[model samples]
Every structure is written in structure tokens, then in C-alpha cells.
Target: MRPLQAKIIADLHVQPVIDPESEIRRSVDFLKHYLQHNPQYRSYVIAISGGQDSTLAGKLAKIAITELNAHHTLNYQLIAVRQPYGEQIDAVDATAALDFIQPDQTVTTNIKSSTDAMTLALRDSGLIVNDLSRGSIKPKMRMIAQYAVAREYDGIVIGTDHAAEAFAGFFTKYGDGGTDINPLWRLNKRQGRDMLRTLEAPKTLYEKIPTADLEDDHPQLPDEMALGVSYDYIDDYLEGKNVPNKASEKIEQLYLTSAHKRHEPVTIYDTWFY
Candidate 1:
């Protein structure tokens, strides 16, 4: 490996910077401190899609709320939300996740109506809507539902974006990637599984293949197939290992293109006017 590539890989490795137990404690503490300091935010809201990342984050949030309630006179809670576009094929996994997380409250919101309405409006405006664009609506609509619930309940949306996804920029901007707090932001996918194991998360969560459920016609497509790279490769690359050249190049391309998603919108200031 070249020196620059080796340095980038080393920089992305997470295990050197994370201890599962300590990370869990820090996440819990961070949640408690955030809620305590922010008087308006009364709860943590998580959009649970039955994925391991969301499941793990929701479980940790629940634990934090429980710990906070025991020590303080706070009524903080964790709200696990399920936003399916229609009848989700993986609804069973979502149900299982709910059972495991055991959130303080649950909300089911079907996003089909909202997405369909928006698509129709866009079509009426003389725009062509393709399958990929339609699929992208799911996460955006899910985020909308989550924020609506957060507003109603005075809660902050919790996100599951971690180092694995961040390294490849594998998340939707202003969608699943949008959240008020990201407790798992620093952990890689493998580290996330380690945390799940430490937290005693369900075996199903750690064992299931990750998917975005974007293919409406075929809902079972694995995320690796969609991204054209397996998470194992991504994780390995992020852990400072020598990955295949193709995988490394693809990762770099994704990271570069999605850089905009990871940052706030750029705007030029009116210096002369000021």
C-alpha cells in the first residue's frame, strides 16, 4: 500500500479509539447530559427499521432513559417509530426489534401516502420520477415522520450513522442521516456488532444481512448488492487493513461524492453588503 492510502486506513480504524463498555457508558452519559442540559427535549425518538444499527441505538437510548429516570426526577423516554412505505416485507423483523428494545412508546406511520402525494405533485410539475428517485423517497419520508413525532413529543431524533456507513457515505442525506443526536457515530459496523453483543442485543440483529429495503419490486436485496461492495470489505478498509484496490477506489469515490451529505450546505456571505 502507498503511504497516503496506509495513513487514510489507519485514520479510519475505530478499535484503537473505542472500548465497547466505555463507549456504551459514554453514550448513555451523553444522552443523559444532553437531555438534562436541554430543557425542551423531553425524549429520544428513533426510527426503527429492524436494522442492527437502529436496533442497537434504540436499545442504548432506552437504557439511558431508564438510568436517568432512576437517578433523577426526569420523565425522559425513548420512542421507537416504524415508518413503512406500505406493507413492509420485513415487518416481522421490525416487530422482533420492538420486542427487544421495549421502548417507552411505539408509533407506526405509513409513509406511502406522503411519498405518493409528493411524487404526484412533482410529476404534475413536468418532472420524470424514476424508480431510484422513488426509492430514495422512503428514507426522506421516514425522516419527516420522525421529526413530526419529535416535534409533537418534544423529543430529539436519534440516528444510527456509524463509521462504517460514514466511511463509505452509505446513508441518505437529510434522511436516515439526519438526526439530532448520533450515539453510534464513531463506531464501525464491526464495532457496532461488538457493542450489540456486549449489550446482549438479540442474535437476530447481529446475524441478519443489512438491507435498505429500497427495491419495492424485490424487497430482499442486500445492501452490499446495491452498494456494489460488501460491508466486510468496507469495515476491513476502515480498520486499516489492506483491502482490494477496487474496494478501496470505490470507497474513496463514495466518500468524495457524499462529502456534501456530511456537511452543512455551503453559502457565500454578502461581505460587501455587511
Candidate 2:
């Protein structure tokens, strides 16, 4: 059984050429609206990695701040942060994104020690400790940094994880996968790319290979290699089409199996409804 099957309820097939401008607009609007309506959070903290997904998310957040400032004249500010583990392009991307947005606050932290701590904690757990899980240690460390920054700044962590990653279970639980707000939750990679293009994000970000920079000089994992199928094929199967190839079949099964992660925990009701 694959993880993807249980997570997806319906497949909405959208062509690449389809106009996603409206979708982008709606997503941005929703995030802004949520911020305005929710009084608990004072600011928004964006984890800027300079990848297309995070870059796009950061741009949209900037636009939201601009919109709110224009109408309400609030004192809210966006905070751009980078948590560098091993040496890689992540910090470069984070710095570039910070320059682009000129966040009201910026901070960088060396989280290698924290990464080690997380790896040890995971080892104590009973789950099988594989390379992928070990690789997730850095992300867990970054999540701790983000949460600390969020508390200090009276804000919440914003994320760029989209449907594709969620469907594939590519993120670490309570790590990079956890966020106070996710503006890209509904959008998949293709839609995310479209939004990035629409927002005129940096070309380098779009062109750069996707790497999380967990390990020093860590190589980026391709979607196919990581998930046993390509994102394009997963996207197709998730959209309800009968996936023909063997790769697609395995991907579909994995997606279905991982569906439980996307939803709230299931619990037995103490009392039946009348």
C-alpha cells in the first residue's frame, strides 16, 4: 500500500497552461485575511530558503503586508530567517530572499548542534532510522529555531510546503512539516511555479536545484528518486487519471498510504451524538 491514496479525496486536473493567476490571488488574499482577523499573532515569520516555493511564498507574504499597511496602517512586520546546518546554497538563497523582501527583522542561526540533538532523539524512538529520517534532523533543528524566533517576535512560522510534498510525506513531522500557517497548502509544485513566475521572483531561485541543505554539501534529491516516481506523474495520478506506468502505480500506492498524515488524528468518541 502506498501513502498517497488515503490523503487525496478528489483529483482536480489542471493543465500547465491554465490561468493560475486567480488562484494565486485567492491564496494571498486568504493569508492576509487570516492575519487581519486573527489577533493572536503580531507578525509573520517566513523561512526563506531561496527555493522557488519558499521564494514565492515569501513574495506573497510581502504583498499581504503591503496591503495591510495600506488599509489599516498597522505596525506589523515580516521576519525573514535562515537556519544553516551544513554548508550549502540554502543560506545563499535565504540571504537573497531576505534582500528581496527586506524583512523588518532578520536573523541567522547555526543549528548543527541542534540537528545532532534531534538525530539522537529520533534514534531513541522505535521507528526505523533510515537515511531519509536521519536527513530530516536538520529540518527539525530549523523548526526549533523558527519556533524560538516566532516566540521572541510574537509571530508564527510561515511555510511553503505544498500539496505535492504533503502527499509524498517528504517533510519531517513537527519539523519543517509543522507550521503556524501554510499559504501554499493547496497549491502543488506546478501551481507554485506559476505563482512564482507571476510574482516575478528571482530567476536564480527558480533555476537552482532544490536542496534542503541539511547535510554539508548535501546533494538535492530528485522527486522520482526519493519517491520512486516523478512529481509530474504523482500529480497526474493524484488528479484522478489512470496512471499507466509502473512508476506511477507505486507512487499512487504510496500516496494513498500516507493520506492519514494530512488529516487530524482519529479518536473514538466518548459519547455518541443524539
Candidate 3:
């Protein structure tokens, strides 16, 4: 490791940004306060992918909803929606996540039809769609499905995006990354696992490898394999650790190239008024 990178790593690790117990309290309070301030939103909607991030966020939202219901006259619901492109091979994990979250309502929305329709439309328009392009549709469709449920229930969609994945831009833009509220925005993958343990999340959820499950041809591909870098290195880099040169360069490239995913849509101004 270079001296500068090593020094940065040492500094970052010396003072951690996340504390499990405090983060839990702050997150739960943030959810409650956010809903209270935004009266129109009566529920919280989350896409439960049976991954550690989602499970942790969903469980935190559930706790906030329950606490709000107890002290306030307003009734808040935590709606966990399972969106599968087709038949989910890891259906058991999703089921287990729901069991642990115990959301107020559960909805299953299959996005295969919608994705197919979009692909067909594009094909009819004389565009040759490839596997990678086609696979990107799944996360966008999932976001659409989640918003549909949230709209119906007067809820805001909750996101599980965190520092580790955000560093690599390891999410579909305006897709799984699209959400109204993100309670787990600052936690890294390691910190997320710690939070899950603190919340007493099911062991299966924390133990399982993270995957986007978006590829139709290679559905079982893990996130690390897809990204060409492992979470350990990602987390270390995120914490300002000195990772190998190859890993560091790849991480920097991903973060730089995918910067657009972190921002809102860009639009040309029609006119400037003085």
C-alpha cells in the first residue's frame, strides 16, 4: 500500500462513522419524524430482496411504524413487496425475510410481463437488444412496481442503498436506487451486517451472499463477481483503507463512471428568467 493511502486508511478506521445501537435509534427516530412531518405519506414501502441491506432497512422501518402507531393517532403501515422478474430461485430467502420483517402487508408483483413488453417494444423499434441492456430493465421494473404499491397505499418507497455499494455505484440508476427515503444510506456492508445482528435479523439473511438477481441468463451470479471486486476490498476502500492497486483503480473507475447514477436526471433549461 502507498504511504498516503495507508495514512488515510488509518485515519478513517480510527474513528468509525457508524455505531450499531446509535444508528438504530437514529434511523427509527428519523422514520417516525419523517412520516409525521409528511402527513400525506401514511405508510412505508420496501422491496424485500431477502438480502442483508433490505432486511435491515425493512426491519428498521417496521419498528418505526410500530412505534408511531403506538403513540400517534395516525396509522402507519410497513408494506414489504417481493418483486421477481419470473420465478425466483431464492424464494425461500425472500419468504424468510418477510417472516423476519413481519410487515403489515405483503405483496407479490411479477415484473416479467412488464419487462417483456418493454423488450418487445424496443425490438419492434428496430433496436437489437442485448442481454446486458435487457437485464437492466428488471431493476427499473421493480422500482415501478414498488412505486405502484406505494402510490396506492399513500406510502413512500424505502431504499437500502449504503456507502459500500454507493462507492462502486453498484446499483441500477433510478431503479433499485430510486426511493423516497433511505434509512440505511450511511451504513457500509460490514456495518449493515452488524446492525442486522443487533436487530436480531435471521441468521440466514446475514449469511447469504448479496446478488441483484437481475440477469436472466446468469441468475445466480453474485454481486462481487459481477463487479469484479469483492465487498471486503470495497468496504476497506470506503473506510479509507489502502487496498491493492488493482482493486483501488477498479473501484475508482466504477465510482467515477457511474457518478450519474447518484444524481437526478439532467434536463436542458427552456429559458432563463431574470
Tens digit of per-residue lDDT, candidate 1, span 67-186: 989988768889999998889887888998999899999999899999999889989999897777878887899999999999999999999988778766678888888889998876
Model 1: what TM-score? Answer: 0.92
Model 1 worst lDDT run, 10 consecutive residues: 265-274
Top-lDDT structure, candidate number: 3
lDDT of 3 by residue, 101-194 (tens): 9999999999999999999999999998788888788889999999999999999999998877876678888788888988887677888898
lDDT of each: 0.83, 0.70, 0.84
lDDT by residue (1-274, candidate 2, tens digit) is 2344433624322333436688778777987888888877767887777787778877788878777777875677788887666565456676677777678788887787776666677678866656666676667777888898999988878987777777666777777878888887766666677777776777777766555544333466554565676666766655545566696667666665665555555567423211
Which stretches in model 2 have alpha-carbon errors above 4 Å?
1-18, 118-131, 215-218, 239-243, 269-274
lDDT of 3: 0.84
State the lDDT at 273 in candidate 2: 19
Q: Rank the candidates by TM-score, best first.
A: 1, 3, 2
Preferred candidate (TM-score higher): 1 or 2: 1
**Worst 10-residue stretch by lDDT in candidate 3?**
6-15
